[model samples]
Structure formats: structure tokens, C-alpha cells
Target: RGGPTACEFSFVLETLGSKIAAHEGEYADSDCYEILSELALLGRYELRALKLELRLAIEGVRADKFELPYRIASERTGCGFLILPVTREFHDRAFNALQSLSLASKHELELERQVGIGMWKNSEFVDVEWIFLEGGNPPDPDLEGRLAFSYPFRRVSEQRLPPIFT
Candidate 1:
């Protein structure tokens, strides 16, 4: 009996397929390349629960100074990662939609912020990278305020889909 694992696998595959199909145009860009790669991996493995690594390039947060949670235990499930303070208006909506879908996956998916060691940037901006860290480092403490938070994706499905460029 495949049990819940089978159901979870089907759900994950459907979610990934719909999202990728809806946003086929995004794969052409290098920035979203990694995101696309990871999505492809999840679909291949049919993973139900996964940890998302956020390589958050805070405009100033030092690698040493940056902090993460001691553990990862979210009330929701599924793998969905979202970044914050998006400079582009278009990407802002895209990230928001992704967060919503991920939250609704009914799997244990969480987002963690990461920083580069001794890396520096010009302005008060952040670059986010969403990765699957199943056997890698665990998630850090959740960030407060508008800067970061696990996305809430309750009504994610084929009908209520995120905006994907073709």
C-alpha cells in the first residue's frame, strides 16, 4: 500500500507540473534557473516533505551576524520558498503566488534565510534563493516583519494558479 506517500507524490507532481507549465518562459532566465532546476528535481523524486534553503543576500546582513532557527517545524506541508523586498514589481507578484501554492501543498515545507560569508552589496536589498535541503542544513529561526515569513498557500490548486509566463 502506497498510502499517504502515494497521495503526497501525486499532489507534488501535479503542483510542479502545473506551475512549470504555466511559467515556461521563466526557465530562459538565469536568475530563475536554479529555481526551475530544483522544481524539476522534486518532480522526478516525487518528494512529499522537503526543506527549502533561502540564500538571502541581505544588502548588509553579515554571514557571521546572520542567524537561523534551531529547528524546523511548520504547521503546513509541501515545498515552497519565497523571497522578500522584491525590487521588481512583476517578480513580486510571482513570488507571492508561489508562496501561496507551496503553503497549501499539505507537506512540511519551510523557508530559511542564508547569507554569504564576508559578502557585501551596495544597497539595502536582498536576493533570495530557494533550494531543497533535505539532508543538508536545517532551517533557521523565522524572520519577523515584512522582510521574511513562510508563505501562506491554502487555496493552491489547478484552478487557482499562479501567474506563469509562456
Candidate 2:
């Protein structure tokens, strides 16, 4: 027999703020407009024109600020399924989770394949130019084509494992 609590209100505010700051008009056509409008009426949260101000502030921030590089992903080439890299801001936790699995010898291929599928599903910024497989020896040309694949995530290779400091 309970109604919405103070915590719920605070949660909504935090979520709205994140949505506002992370990407301005990302929610412009969504319910955020209505929620922000209603919340502005409360006058308790300093909501007076908050959404407009937020949109203006977010406009100053470029979209690239929200992008992350070298996300673990995969693709289906003429050669077959090849693990690769992609760039995006979301699904970071999923990428990190699968990357951890890829580090373990027992789970490398299986987990890498899963990460590739996850990227493939997103399909927003998938890259197939340079495929990254986890090993010193490259796969067969018939399996992965000589120029297509690269052995990344190694100490010697030009490619670097990330958590690349900003």
C-alpha cells in the first residue's frame, strides 16, 4: 500500500541529468520532454527551464565525447566470421566482461566470438579493416586472409591493449 518515495524522485532526477548531459537531444523526441516539463512545475528541484539549459549545454559538447574506441566486435566477411574492433560509448560493461573472458586461455575463442556478436548486434560503428585475433601466430590465409587480420593485444605488436589513458 505504498506510493512513490523520495528516493524514487531522486532517482528520476539523476537519470534525467545523465540523459541530459550525456547526449542532448538524444531524448528530445522521447518522454524526457514531458517528464522534464512536469518536473519543472514542481519548482523544488530548480527545474525552471532546466531541460532547455541542459540541451544548450549538451549542444556545446561534441558527440565524439561520448564515443569509446576499439570495442571488441565481430563481422561476417567472405572469409567467414572474423573478430574485429568497433567504436561506441554504450555496452562498455559488456565489452569489459567479455574481454576478461578472452584473457583466459580456456575461454579466449568462445568469449571473443561472443564479444564480436555483441558488436555485430549493435552494428553502429563496426570496423573490418583490421581484424584482431588473440595469438602470436596468425590464422590460415584461407581462414582469415593474409592482409585482413592482425595479431593485436600483444606487447610487441603496434596495436595496444586498452584502458588507453586519456
Best by lDDT: 1
Q: Where does the lowest 10-residue lDDT sum fall in candidate 1?
A: 113-122
Candidate 1 regions exceeding 4 Å error are 25-33, 39-166
Candidate 1 accuracy as TM-score: 0.25
Computed on alpha carbons, the lDDT of every model, listed in order, comes to 0.32, 0.31
lDDT by residue for model 2 over 1-166, one digit each (tens)? Answer: 1333434334335755665566675544333454344344333223222223233222222232331222222112111121222234434554553344233311323322221211312353321111222333334344333223543332211222232133
Considering every candidate listed, which one attains the maximal TM-score?
Answer: 1
- What TM-score does each of the candidates earn? 0.25, 0.19
Q: What is the lDDT of residue 70 in candidate 1?
A: 14
Q: Which tens-of-lDDT digit does each residue in 29-101 have in candidate 1?
A: 3324444554454431122223222233232132323222111222223334332223333343534433433
